[model samples]
Target: MAELLAPASCPLCLGGDNRFYHQDKVRCYWHCAHCALVFADPGSHLAADAELAIYRQHENNPQDSRYRAFLNKLAAPLSQRLGTTGLTGLDFGCGPGPTLSLMLQEAGQQMAVFDPYFANEPEVLQQQYDFICCTEAIEHFYQPAKEWALWLTLLKAGGWLGLMTKLAPTQDEFARWHYKNDPTHVCFFSRETFLFLAERDGFTVEFIGNDVILLHKKALS
Candidate 1:
């Protein structure tokens, strides 16, 4: 069982270090002491085919008021920061429907959508954007450090990276947390984890909401 619980490293910080955090009959969790990220063992991740199947079942309709409202938690705050004008952004990991992209477009922002499974557009990844919105996606990252580096590279200097993911709970709250139950959610982050990344990556982190954060890329000197 030791071998089963041993994840090679913390996917978020690339530290070959972590302490056992939690476990159930199905999956085990780890806590990265360096970055304060709680992640599930890699062996617990779902197969690519199965993951895509689950994504395909999502009803992320842009017309759904409830869904739009959920996305507004990130969109509204990001829009306020960007203002109403010629804003260009990327909707990273936009799932199958790309509702967030539509919402931003309606608010007069030119948005590009990309998802490894849905909108696999490599060219979009190659372009630099004024801002990037990654709603409901960060938790699904398998190699979070690599993905985060890519986001920093894709943004123009002084650009914004808006993300939406539920923060990890305290040790006492972990057992009852429902977010970890999702097989697709591998890496879980807390405010401390975000602050660590911000300090390391030269970003200015702001918690716009309980589940929303905005990381501003520092302008070059």
Candidate 2:
């Protein structure tokens, strides 16, 4: 058996470096003592340039009606739930071109965009938002403990946080899953894992689809 290692601190909580009790061929996942987020090590990730090239292959176009319709699966419901909060939002990891922020803007919501590769605006991280969107981005988190808590801080109380990423399946299938093969994808989350996090925090969560989850602060308990 591979020896489990202790993280310097839980990636999400910063409470303390938690121990990683799980591992596989390519990665080790650490469970945060404070938050239940299991994350891969940052050192295990692909280089920034390589990660950028991978993102460049994505086709996220606001003009693409099908894609818009696909995004609406998350956008429409979240908008309906949030109503007119007048809360500005940050789209974490908005990729090379930010279509999700565009969709939110089209819905008459204000949003700031940020991505390590595409829109690396560290300044945006300073200001908080009414809500935050991390679509298809969480799986790429090499440091979930830190990034997620910061994302939580960015949202105002009672604000919504939306995410879209494929849930990790059982280990039997994960070994052969293509989603796990992406060099840029380091972290994997299951619906149960997300629900656990939300429940631990004060947020309430609604799964819009197998790939989308909408979290409202009100539900955080």
Q: What is the C-alpha lDDT of each candidate?
A: 0.90, 0.77
Q: Where does candidate 2 have its weakest 10-residue lDDT segment?
A: 29-38
State the lDDT of candidate 2 residue by residue for 28-130, as single tens digits. Answer: 6565545555566666778878878878999887688898788778888888887885569888988876888998987788889998888987999998788
lDDT of 1 at 207: 96
Name the top lDDT candidate. Answer: 1
Candidate 2 structure, TM-score to reference: 0.81
Candidate 1 C-alpha lDDT tens digits along 95-199: 988999999899999999999999998999888999999988999998899889899889998888999999888988988999988889898999999999999
Clashes (backbone N, CA, C under 3 Å), per candidate, total 0, 12
Distance from true location, Cα of 207 in model 1, Å: 0.9
